[model samples]
Target: MAVIHRAELRPTKLELLAAWLPGRRWYQGHADADVVRVAAYRFDDPAGAVGIETMLVSAGDGPVHQVPLTYRDAPLDGGDDWLIGTVEHSVLGQRWVYDACGDPVYVAALAGVILTGGGQAEEFLEVDGRLEPRETPTLVSGSGSEGADVPGISEILRVIEDDPTLVVTDSVQLAVVRRLDGGNRLPGAALTGTWNGQPNPMPLAYVSTR
Candidate 1:
């Protein structure tokens, strides 16, 4: 079937980020910036229920960053508590952007995967007003069979740029995998492409260490 769970050009979550990103630790500045939805793509889930969307939100803050986020169908236990916002779906008609990981069905599915892979689903949630990594609260599941492992940020990294995807997994994102082809340094673990067609995967940090 289609790999994307929910594929459509609907209203993006840009408006929400206008007030969210600046508050994040990763946000650069602009004090009060606005988010513009550029391009968005959804990943195909083994199931047909859960919603996993990858959005490219751009702010007027000079450079842009690819913010990959995961959305679910079920109502997250915490609602917008941890999520950006919740509202009726524009294209799907009426629904909310639930952070699937919060649902019990999804939790169970993730637990099942980890159980078989010798790992556990750790919910990196905000506790005491601070985002921290904690053990899975309970068993979680998905709305439908649309449950699958979330990809690390590295997947966005063009393999033609760096070496094998970096095994980095502590930051909730995968490192770039592919090959470097120039003298510049790669910025983050993931990069979109070169500005002037310099080198694709220049170096994330210094240059060639992979």
Candidate 2:
């Protein structure tokens, strides 16, 4: 379960992304355009120290984007390459934010979800010193691993394409799909999850063995 804080965040999420999105190679919108958050989901970290979130946003009239982010109380080691920047949380103080792809905690949590039939983190909003169950507009579930010691590198598909290029071999297992088509079923997903409003399961990430 994940606790949702109703408190304020300095520089807000969108504000941070607005300044950073333009530099991303995969971002397809005008970086200066006002970004609108469309939907989001979360995955829980077992240790409860890291906050993992994936936000879907739209800049102006462009296509929706999937941005996975991880929040930490301290700076992540060797994460400057993927760091989105930092933010101040009213309840948690200073937080170090980074692209989820570079965080081991986020990667492991996602792998755990795929290996174990796990659902998206349950959200409870804190209100007036009380906790209230909040319904996530989008629900996600993962495909569990079969009884096998599968090892691979988990890859995030930055660009959504019509035909996803995935190659799963004895030494590699790839899962890739960004723009999900409800009609097409993903292949060789160690884990497959569905969005609440969509009829199909979207490939969360691809795991490739080394």
Candidate 3:
């Protein structure tokens, strides 16, 4: 399960994305337009140290974009190239945010979900020393079946940023769709999701063996 904190964030997630999105090669919207959060979902880090989130956002009335991020307490060694920026979390103190494509933990979790037909993590908010179930604004699921063998993914060999961000892992390759459209029927296990105005499931990411 993913734990939620009702704390404040300095230069909020949307603010950071607004500044970062335009620089992305695959960004299809105007650079000066305002970016708004559409919806989001989370994946759990088995070690419970890192926070993984996949956010959907839009610039003005432009096409929706998919951005997967990972939050950590400390800098990811040798990941300066993928660093998005830092933010202060009221409950977690300073956080080092990075593109999930460059984070090993996120890669492993995403691969596991796709290969095992898993879904997004269940979320519970921390409220005055108690846990309260929180309804997620988005829902996501993988296409593979339960008990499917998931290869161990420890490192990212390469990352190609494009309309579909391609991440080459130690044992497999992941294609993370940057722009949200109708689902893409790729030749691999895929992760699909649905959010607010989007009732039909759309492809978010795909996993294929090398």
lDDT of 2: 0.68
Worst 10 residues of 1 by lDDT: 201-210
TM-score of each: 0.44, 0.79, 0.97
Off by over 4 Å in 1: 1-12, 77-81, 91-93, 98-210
Q: Which of 1 and 2 is the better model by TM-score?
A: 2
Ranking by TM-score: 3, 2, 1
Model 2 regions more than 4 Å off: 145-186, 190-200, 208-210
Q: Give the Cα lDDT of each candidate.
A: 0.38, 0.68, 0.92
Clashes of 2: 8
Query: What does candidate 2's lDDT look like per residue over 130-205, in tens digits?
Result: 9999987676665664454545444433322222324333344344343333333544444455444554555656
Task: Find the candidate with the highest TM-score and give its number.
Answer: 3
lDDT of 1 by residue, 1-210 (tens): 113223233444676567666765445548566776654333334465665543445677534443434565555554454476554554455445533323333333332332233222233444454556543222222211224343322211211212223322222322321222333344422233322233332222111112
What are the candidates' C-alpha RMSDs? 15.0, 4.6, 1.0
List the lowest-lDDT window of 10 residues for candidate 3: 179-188
